[model samples]
Each structure stands twice: as C-alpha cells, then as structure tokens.
Target: MTGNHNAAPTTQNSAADIEMEPFTPHRHEQCRRFQIVSASGLSYEIFVSIPRQAPPPEGFPVLYLLDANADFALADQVLERLSRRPEATGVAPAILVGIGYPETEGYNQPRRHFDLTAGPTRDPFYAKTALTFGGQSAFIAFLQDRLKPLIRSRFPADSRRETILGHSLGGYFVATLATAKPDLFSGYIAISPSIWWDRDGLLASLAVPSPSRPQTIRLYLAAGSQEGETATGEQNAGTQTSAHDALRQRRRMIGNVRDLAERCKAVCRDAVDLRLDIIADEDHSSIFVACLPKALRFTLPFSSAD
Candidate 1:
C-alpha cells in the first residue's frame, strides 16, 4: 500500500515505553544489614558479610572493621576477591562486620573524634580548637558488652580467630583496645595509626603492661613513607611555620609508631607477634588503600591445604 512520506509515524507501547518500577541499587549478594543500640543509647548500623562457603569445623573467622561508613565497601570487596581463591592467596574466607553510625554524613565526625581519642589533647594547637576527647573507654565497653554478644548470637563466629581492622583515628582506637584489653581479639591491623595523637601520649602510655593473655596475639602496624612530610610547603605560615611544623609532625608520627611497636613487643614478650611496615611511596591520605591488601594477608593468613 502506498503511503504519504510526510505522514506521522505510528508509536508502539513496547516494553521499553511501558512504566517500570523505580531503580534501586543492587544489594550485595552475601551482605546483610542490621541495627544495634550501644550502651550510650546510640543506634549503629552494622553491615555483615558472610562467606559463600560452608563454615569450617571450628567456625568462620570474623573481622571487625571500624569507620564502616567509609571503609566497608573496600573491606567487603577485598575479602570477597582474595578469599575467592584461598589456595593461591593464602587468605581464608571469613565474616566481615562493619560498625557505622546511622547519620546522613558518611561519618559522624564529632562522635568519632570523641570515641577514638584516648584522652584530651595536650598540644596547644589542638587544644585551641576545643575538640572533644576521652570516650574510648565507653566505646570499648559497648563493643565488649553489647556488640560482640549480638554478633556471636547471630553468626557462627570463631572467637579465637577474631580480628580487628582500623585506620587513622580508628587505628588509634585499635591501639587503645589492644593495650587495654589484649585478650579481646587475636589479631589487630592498625594501618597508619594516629600515634601522634594527643602529643604522643598514647605512644608514651604503651610502656604500661598490657593485660596478660594465653592466646597468641598478632599485630600489624604500617605507615606510608611519605606521611607527615612537607615536600611542597603548600600550607600558609602561621604562629608555627607550617612546612617545618608538618615535617616535624610527620617525623614524630613515624618515630612514635616504631617506638610503640617496640614497646608493645617488649611488654607483650613472647605473647605478641608484632610486625611493622613502611609502605613505599605512600602518604597519610593514600596509605589505607595501599596497605589494606598486605594488612589483610598478614592478619588473615591461611594455609593452601585448608
């Protein structure tokens, strides 16, 4: 049939043109979400990732990750990829639990500042800023009394294989927990820990005796080679010369971490297995991602025959 070339084209109600449901982000296949209230009455969002394989005879190992709002995705992905081929990687499959705040901000900065720091800042510079501190004790109580029990009830967790991973302020929290309650976790991975916090008081306090425990403790401490450097002198000069001050601070951080590791080894004696690393060509901002793979290998090592 002949038709006019200028005639209006017919429209069809094809599947693509039909109305469809709104798009929602696809959830991770093995991850689940839940909420729990802390001892201080703060509600926290917890993300749990379980392995696809069946649990071993003892149970699945568990890793408690801090700063979950920002780090959970990376932790989950790394665990999944490495554990996929345990024979090649020597990393076993395990459960990963990320503890994060429910606030709209990816992180609750004020709460973290209060929870992570062991005590008030003695440095005049930080003191002038009026930041809050000294909530580590309460947070640890919450973890021990409230969170850990809940996790145990919900999952087949191997208490002996439990590990904790933290970076920056979270790393500081890890250190505080390791010293204050050494029996809590079997392994601790503190990447670029803020040993320089509170005028190095935390590092200084490491000289005190850690609680004696029968279980072997594995600790992995790492920092970026470029951390705390003033290579470009880009900051503005103030009461203190920014570049010089920054360089000094960086040197202090490196030194303090090394000293803390050594002191921990001494006090822990044969009970603790400590390993410290300086990641090449990395800095404070980039260290976490760069060091996480090695940190995971160290903290979660497994044999090929397993």
Candidate 2:
C-alpha cells in the first residue's frame, strides 16, 4: 500500500461523519468543464474526460461519478493512468462524467443530502444532523431527462455501457438507484454506502426481475473492514465523535454492504453480475479511493492480453 502524492486527494474530517466533501483538485485540460441547471433548478458542475485514443465502433463505455467535487480528478487520473495498457489492467478507456455541486465549497453538504437520499428521511441516523434530505427523484430525473441525453448526443458513448458510482451517502444513492431502476445503467459501484439510513435500510424494498435488470447488470460493492472501528486523532475528539463512532460500529458498514451483496446475489441471481470487496485495513474515506481501480475494472471491463 504505497501512496501516490501526485494523485488527487479526497478527504472529509471525521468530525463531519455525515458530510462528504473531498479536496478539489486543480483542473486539467483532460477534463472538460461546464455548468448546467437540472430541470428542477438545481445547478451542477460537470467534469468530463474523453479517452486519449479513438473510441470503438460501438463507442466507449461511460461512467457517471457522484461527488465530483472530491473524486473527479482522482477518477480521471485513474482512467488515464491505467487505460494506456487496458490489455493488462482490464481497465479500459471510457468516458468519465463527474456530477458535482456548483457551490464553492469542497462539497455542498445540504445539496448532496437532498440529491442523494430517496424519498423523505426518517432515519434515526440524522436525529441530530441538520441537513436536508429526499431529493433523489428530482436528481434522477435530471440525469435521465437532461444530462444523459446530452452525453449521448455530444459524445460517442455506448448507450448500454454506462456505470454509476458513489461513495458513502453517494454510495447509498447508487445502491438505491440500482434496485429502483436496475436497467437504467449496465453497471453499479457503491463504496462504503450508508445503509443505516433506514431500519430495513435502502435495499429492503427493491423488487428484482421486474421485466428489466436481467443478465445485463453488473454490480460491485465494497467497504473497508476498518470503516466501523474508531480512529484515534484530534479530528475525532469529543463527545460528538464518540457518538458517531458508536453509531458507526452499530451500523456495520462492511457487514451492511456484505449483506446487500449477498442478498443481491441470491435474489437477483443470474440477473446481475455481482461482486464485493472488503479492503483489509481501510476505513470509510480511504476505502473509496482504494477501491476505485477495482470498481472501474468491474464496471468497464477490458479483455486481457493473452
């Protein structure tokens, strides 16, 4: 486990356990940038990266990444660094589309909670946290009716090879979308998803084999084994930190995802290509970045050189 200093960094303090805002990386020419308002009137900052090489006849697979403010640069760099030798890595060239907030902060906390959660939030997890919730429907509408159409028309993207990825709360969103609309995308990557959002959690209600989501879905879920354990540091000091830590353990992030993966496996069966990875010593934050390369492989698989 060596660290690359050049790689874009994404981190949120343990203090704001519920909040996810990663360090914004310096913009590079590889990523085209723009701003667009969803029909719901929510403004979003979009970051897109096209392959350096020519696309296949069917076009390149496309990935729609959530929480772009933090992970866009990291994702783009990962694709660029590995895709050069797709035959060996199985991480092929694909269109990278990052969906983020237009606000200046590393992450727009209020907006994200609203955009990521499904329906109204009655989760005890947010008893003390004062953030808005339940706007995923509107956000999904934007992606379907607005952003996606724009991507197809403007880029040589394969309609059937799209993937949607998210971490933490964003991971919660990805998982929710996977079940509610399994046929919406070909692949799903959810890292350290916040399944504690409800008692039965998000996947409790997802009915499978709905005439869609059969044999075409690829799902990869991951969480760090250490995600439930408490860490020692000033950033995690005080009573509030203890409360969150206790909850973290109770919530069982790794187990939650593991259960979801298994459930998806048994229930969906041949309907979905499902995989789960538990990073040995990583935590919630570290697990997201640590698992990106694998996520890409599962979602956008490339044939290995014989």
Candidate 3:
C-alpha cells in the first residue's frame, strides 16, 4: 500500500517506538494526542484518534490497548472505515488509544514475550535478541492502574466500555488478561493467540473462574484457516519464514482458538458471549486485518446498551 504522505504526520512524541507514523489516512479532525508513562520505568509510547467533528461522547466506547506499535496504523484504518458504516457494527465514532512500542528496528517481530508472555523462560525465538521479553504482567498493570485512568480523565469512556485487541503473542496477552482480570475490560478480541506459549499455561488458566459480574462480557476469537497446514506436509520452525509455514501457523493457532472458545462456552457459557471465526485462506499476518471489522463489530456493537 502506498503511504499517505498527505495525511497528518505522527509526531515523534514519545520514547517508545523510535518513530511512529499514521498507518492510515487521517481525514477526521477531533484527533487527540497521548503520552506514555509506565511505572516500571520501561519507556513506551501511545496515541489516540477520534472523530473529526464531535467532541467525544461521555462514556464512549474506546479500544484501549494495542500491541505491535507498527501495526497501529492498520488498525486505525480499519476502525476509520468501519465506524462510518451504519450496517456494519453501527458503533458510533469513538477514540482509539493505540499503545505503541519503544523499538526502532525489526518492528514486525515484537519483544512480545516481554510485553505479553507471563513466565520467565527464555524462548529460543527471542533469546538474547535486541528486543527484550517478559513485561506483559507489568504492561497490564500499567494499562489497568495507570494508562486507562489517565485516558478516562480526558475522554468520555465507560468504566466497562473497553476492548483489548492483540495479534499473535499480543493475542496470548489478551486471553491471559481476560481470565486473570475479567472485570478490567468489557471485551476482548484475540487474533491467532500464541497458544504454544508456556505449554498453553495461559489457556489453562482460563479454565478457572473469575469473580462473577453483573453482566456478560463479549469475546471474539478468530484465526486464519491456513495456520497448521503448509504446501508441504510437515511442521518445522525453520520454515516459519516461508509463506507455507506462515499458513501452517494460522491453522494451528485457529485450532487452539477453537479449543479456547469451547472452553469459554463450557465455563462461562451463560456469563460470556464467545464467538469464534475461522477465516478461510488467510495467514497470521493478514488475519488481523481481515478479521478486524468483523471482530470489532461483534465485540463492540453500535447499538445502545439499553
């Protein structure tokens, strides 16, 4: 896709991601700015975009946390397009608080183990890499305790009008967060979670119950159908970079999502709204883009809560 050079440029405001750019066209006017202040002293950066016309509504629904700073623009684009569609989610114009990373190089491969993973083992995938691992627990604390309150102070966000969306390891983070503190956010959209993490420790944790809530929260889980199978018949880490391996990962991840969805149905059947979508022929990288509108529509409906 051609870069929208004419669109409003993203300021290099925070020390989080070395540089941040608007991944989507910014036609709207009510754009707002944000800064990062993590208690862990871990430097991070984030931004928020809103409708061009109206002041944000009180108790407005907002997408809270986003992983992979580089991917924020794509999400913003998706939201910008979908929010205009009356038939789609019917969701009103709202703010998108995109939490970005603090890295400048190799942005696609996130130090997600640090930002998303729960435990302390150095997985070979990210061991001794320039990017660090294992900050997710703190990250969540940052969101729940600090960043969120800061956003609420400025915008009209409902106490329960938040949705956390993540991809890959980020997906793993959302699932872990949902089960660990279900009340913290109102909805969850996990795309192709890394179910392989810690031998599915996060997935297993979801089996346990959280304190019951007065109302049910919604969850939308989607995976690409191409995750597990490749043009070749086998699975190997060496092939991860291959287009084929990418396809396989989606399949494998989707299977894991299905299992989790089933588990959600079994455990919080009546208390939660769980929907699993398997997109045909899409791979991991494309799944989030392909699934975003539907995911957002399903999780955060435009209709009034009344």
lDDT against the true structure, each candidate: 0.72, 0.76, 0.66
Say which candidate scores most in TM-score: 2
- TM-scores for candidates 1 onward, in order: 0.82, 0.84, 0.79
Tens-digit per-residue lDDT, 114-138, candidate 3: 6676665434554566554566777
Cα lDDT, model 2, residue 293: 91
As for lDDT, the candidate ahead, 1 or 3, is 1
Each model's number of backbone clashes? 0, 0, 20
Ordered by TM-score, highest first, the candidates read: 2, 1, 3
**What residue runs in model 1 are displaced by over 4 Å at the alpha carbon?**
1-27, 199-214, 231-251, 304-306
Worst 10 residues of 2 by lDDT: 1-10
- The clash tally of candidate 2 reads 0
- Candidate 3 has a TM-score of 0.79
- What's the ranking of the predictions by lDDT, best on top? 2, 1, 3
- lDDT per residue, candidate 1, 136-254, as tens digits? 77678877887777777767888778899988888877876676667778888888887667535565555333455556788889887766454332333334476566556744667
Candidate 2 scores a C-alpha RMSD against the true structure in Å of 9.5
Superposed model 3: Cα runs more than 4 Å off: 1-25, 53-57, 87-89, 102-111, 120-132, 207-212, 231-251, 304-306
